[model samples]
Target: MTKDEFLQFLRDPDVCKEIFEIVKKGGKPAVVAPQVQPQQKFSSIADKLKTVYPNANAPQIQPQPAPQIQPTPQPAQPPKNNAPKGSGSLADKLKFLRGHLDKVREEEQIAAAKAQEKSPAEKYTVISNRRCPICEKDTRVVKTKSRINVEKRDLDYCIHYKDFDPYLYTVLTCEHCGFAAEEKKFSGAWPNKLKETLREFLKQNDMKFPFVEERNAEDALSLFELAILFSEMTDQSKGRQAILNLNAAWVCRCEGFADRERDFMEQAAVDFEVALENERWPINGISDDMATYLCAAIYFLINEYDKSTTWLGRIMNNANLRATAPKLFEQARDMWQDIKRANKA
Candidate 1:
């Protein structure tokens, strides 16, 4: 039976008692088996008794007493003039104000805690043998200390300090060789002066220094180093800028617009090829190898098929790089295959 019908049957005490008796005797109710026709509705006490005692032949049904129903009294209406106006009662207003005050106090505590946790200025030691700018002695090497202005809104002065203000500057002197150099304190922006210094260093060295190459190559390498240092120093903004600079260099390499683009390409190919000699296509992180793939793609686009195939093979063989950039690697593979097929044809 449906739940509603069963519930209605339960509401009737006579029907419930009859069903219980049938269950006690291990007999199915008459309503459940329609093959045995019922003379009257099971809800009726006489019908229920006959159904319960089917073999009794002279069963008498006693009517069950109905439950007494108490009459409900209506409440008296409240007077409209007795109600107070203005939003709500004073108790509710005070409770709301208390909650708001608590929230404010909690926020203030958090702000205060964060303020208290402010990091002291990072100290960087100048390790190179460059002459001391101040003492002129070769043994004045010391640790330079400078605080990062975390609240600086401008991007220019946020990463590294461009201006050489001595107050913001932290000087370190070396004890051994007495080599000293001024490192501009970093906030969030790349120091303008340091970038200028790097640019000048590139120019003075004719871009042929140990780590320097073409413009993009030098920029990429320098930025990558800076990013690594900043990341280690807990300077996230500077680290992010370095990554952006690296990505820009990659784009410039792909577009062939960067100064010394061809030189950078040749150098990069050589680096990757050398890395492949060790059976490690990446030799770095996955993202770094992905940049290598872009370099390979540029070579492929320029009809340097041999170099393209070499780099593409490296990507295909490297399990980590392959997993990270599967789709890009697959495209490179298909392109390489097509080029080979064309050559054979």
Candidate 2:
């Protein structure tokens, strides 16, 4: 019995009365031990021993060993996908390649307007020497450090760069090898298999673009296209590939190539949709809320109103989304409202 059950039994009136009667009679409580019976086979063996030897012990039988199981041999394993063995640094080669190219750097002649004494103006652009992760070649890529904002719009979050269109120079292209990638992709090491595959790919494809510090929209798009090729060869995540395509589309947008821009945007939307379901959270600073908003916006642009509303509804109805991601929540709400108005019209 449990402790509680035992306590309950002790508190029973009949039980207490029985104990009291026993005490009054000067009789001690008797303790009974549970009886255990021997197995039938053992009892029969004992009887056989008594009959055979009259007052002897039972015979002992030797235990048989258990059967051994031999494991089946597995088939030979495939070769591992690993990094290629190399002699010198890929960055060193890229640096040497950059050395031979003409140092033609482009900067907008228009300078930022003088700020008031109290307000400090930041540099608009920064020149960076980045080495390609795939080619290990160094290239100069100009990055926008800060924006001299002329105007900002709610639609597509468009910002007009007054002096320079900095988006044009976001991709880095190695002149020696036809290898190009975004600034973010230049830092990490590649998978061993991917490294070997890219090495082979570079052998056949020669460098197409010259090393230049400044890149136009066409040049930027070319480099982005090259990066997309590399992304396909490697096991790049869908989210990463989607961003590359989106950036390529952004280049097209800056150049006012409406048809190309729409095509790329459509592909980016599809990739982002796939990434939403299969890829991990918080890809390229894109959280679930941010991604949802982008998807909703993209769908709205493509005239997929149902899909747009589906994603927008999720953002609008989430209880804590407004507090957690106020900006994205507001954008989603506005887009949802736009969709409703369009339908009514």
Candidate 3:
């Protein structure tokens, strides 16, 4: 019991009477060991002799060893899907990719105005050289430093910073081959098929990814486009597509581009839903419950109340979900209530 509970127990009249009666009987504490039993007291030479001479105890029946289990031969796993799923080849997709540089230039002036005091690189970000996985060429990559002051976090998992937008450095681009992707996926080993596909994609499209010591908002936008384009053209997992779109939405939100942000959010919701319905479990390292919540949250953000409620209903109707994931269950329930209030309004 806790200290407060013990104090309360001592203060009770009936408990005090019981304690006095226990003391009057001179009873030992519960921790004190009981006297030994008679059966375990067989320490004599006769007992040792009886163990050696098995005939003295009984006719011996030897114990048999447990049977061993041979491992069954398993079927070979299926090869991963690597075929292109986009509308056209990588070159065609690149030709149609949205530049959105008009909005980028608008935001550029705002950022430039702010940078007159102090630039983001002077305090928040640092540059380092890393070998590009696809190109095998060394290129400059931007990295964020710690202790960034947070302004707020939205329910959709977007973080707003007070001083600088750290996500501007999210994507790393190679200057030589024009290959661009997120930093985490930039260096890890890729399947030979995928590596060949990327090399071919770069070769097919005459693109150039020039080095940028300090990434402006437009550079960040272009990197995201390339990453998402790469993912789609290579038929990467739907979950990864959702993540890129979601992050792109946040980046657009940082630039105050509401329409583009909504467009990205809509894509994010669709990709997450596709991942849940058709793709495998533990989609892109995210739990099914979290992906579900993301779909619901994104729908809510886009004012699709019916879709949001439908996804949230799945969580609320699940009896085992509350016990298995209490925190997520509560979040879902709260969102359900918020949807109710929103509908009423």
Leading candidate by TM-score:
3
Q: Rank candidates, TM-score, best first.
A: 3, 2, 1
Against the reference, the lDDT scores of all candidates come to: 0.46, 0.68, 0.78
User: What is the clash tally of candidate 2?
Assistant: 5
Compose the digit string of candidate 2's lDDT tens values, residues 34-136.
Answer: 2334532424433433332342222323568988989999899899633333543576656655653423221222222333222211256566776766667
Candidate 1 error regions (>4 Å): 1-259, 278-284, 287-295, 317-325, 337-345
C-alpha positional error of residue 31 in candidate 3 after TM-score superposition, expressed in Å = 99
lDDT of 3 at 180: 76
Badly placed stretches (over 4 Å) of model 3 are: 1-118, 281-285
Any runs in candidate 2 off by more than 4 Å, and if so which? 1-124
lDDT, candidate 1, 114-155, per-residue tens: 888633222232233434332233442223335433332211
| lDDT (C-alpha) at residue 332 in model 3 | 85
Model 1 global lDDT (CA atoms, 0 to 1): 0.46
The residue-by-residue lDDT of candidate 3 on 251-320, one tens digit each, is 8999998998898899999999998998876844678888898899899889999999999888788898
lDDT accuracy of residue 289 in candidate 3: 84
- CA RMSD (A), model 1: 22.1
- Of 1 and 3, which scores higher on TM-score? 3
Order the numbered candidates by lDDT, best leading: 3, 2, 1
